[model samples]
Target: MTRKIGTEEAIKRWNRFADAYAANHTELGDIHKEVFLNPAIFSLIDTVKNKRVLDAGCGEGYFSRLLAKAGAAVTAVDYSPRMIDIAKERTPDDLPIEYRHGNCEDLNMLEDKSFDLIISNMVMQDLADYEKAFQEMHRLLTDRGCFIFSILHPCFITPESGWEKSKDGKKLHWNVDQYFYEGTYEQKLGERENMLFFHRTLTSYMNTLMKTGFMLEGIIEPKPSEEMLKKYPSFEEDFRCPDFIVFKLKKR
Candidate 1:
């Protein structure tokens, strides 16, 4: 459990990033592509030809639109009104897509067993109640429906332990002192606004999904492409840490 961030505060924090978030990805272009193709998300999209899909934490609806373009009937949902607005704008009007404003913890507004596939990227750490969210996911999925998601890898990404390492000796290093302690981590994006996340153990995460009735399918940790490495000088060093993890689970 963690300190609860009210819906209002959560909404406000994401609103700050809404306008620039897509542009940031656009700016990162190849960099963004590399991250998306990262291990976690890749293994889950085996075949998305014609399925009902939901982008659960669709920050900007980028993946949601991608799935729709790939022939899936897609619905993208986000708690932030600002995010939903941006998602709607980016989505093509002709696509069979819906952008809804809703929290992950309670998908009560949506019909049960309505989705065939669900995808969420970088959403786990942002949630205030993962259990409730997982339960909703289970309820929303039809029998054997697939739920795929990604998050910051708990094993490697610990804050302030230093996001830096050396070329020799310890291939992996961390600040043990800072690693164990947990608190509200705030990244000051502006004078009045900030980015937030919650940190938890890997075991905690696996258990939650299992209890919610998902059979863990796979876990992936991706590396940058050689071409990307040649272009970005710091890619090798900066990407040593597993930045993200994807989980594929079948609803049972």
Candidate 2:
């Protein structure tokens, strides 16, 4: 049986893996972010000039810097202290971003109705108690405020899902299993770190967001654009299966 771990353990693992994880991220974030998530996220976002934005679970703060450059008043938060440190280090002094060490599930340091937009990119599946995190996001946003987030697609990236490659290392179809299992599972980030992830069904995610008073506005299962494909032709296989899902929600 897979052991169930809590949020604290998850954050600890992130702290330990912070350096390796941040190493891969550039100003545009990692390759995955550059190719898939960033396009989908920025497309969903409205004009951010002079708007207040909160980057929940803002890893090493790359997105925060991007938002600030786009003229948003950005407050970025991460549960891992090491991540926050790296984010602060990477951020330029000219960029006006407030980096805080806090969990998305419980951000009492931030006041209510404090932001115009809240973005949690590639973060929802990392921590347990996503319902609480959703509630906290709703609480932090003003009425009609937008919340955008992305995650590994629940329909495809399950705990036991990967490519079903044939012999001789030929390309093959993707494999997904344990879609109903809702708990903690570990996956390796680098050679040494076995990162923890929380899995939930698609229905659970949508219903919980609705219950948290968010009206779903848009969703994108990002595919590499022609430009991206030209840069990374390997992403052409992304047409076969979606690796990530992005959502845009409005506070109601």
Best by TM-score: 2
lDDT of 1 by residue, 165-194 (tens): 567655465432345534445554444577
Error of 1 at 146 (Å): 0.9
Query: Candidate 1 lDDT (Cα, whole model)?
Result: 0.74
Alpha-carbon lDDT, every model: 0.74, 0.94
lDDT of candidate 2 over 68-158, digit per residue (tens): 9999999999999999999999999999899999999999999999999999998889879999999999999999999999999999999
Q: TM-scores across all candidates?
A: 0.86, 0.98
For every candidate structure, what is the RMSD over all alpha carbons to the true structure, in angstroms?
A: 3.5, 0.8
Cα error, candidate 2, residue 62 (Å): 0.6
Candidate 1 at 155: error in angstroms?
Answer: 2.0
TM-score, predicted candidate 2 vs. hidden true structure:
0.98
TM-score: model 1 vs. ground truth: 0.86
Model 2 misplaced regions, further than 4 Å: 1-3
In model 1, pairs of residues that clash are none
Q: Alpha-carbon error at 13 in model 1, in Å? A: 0.8
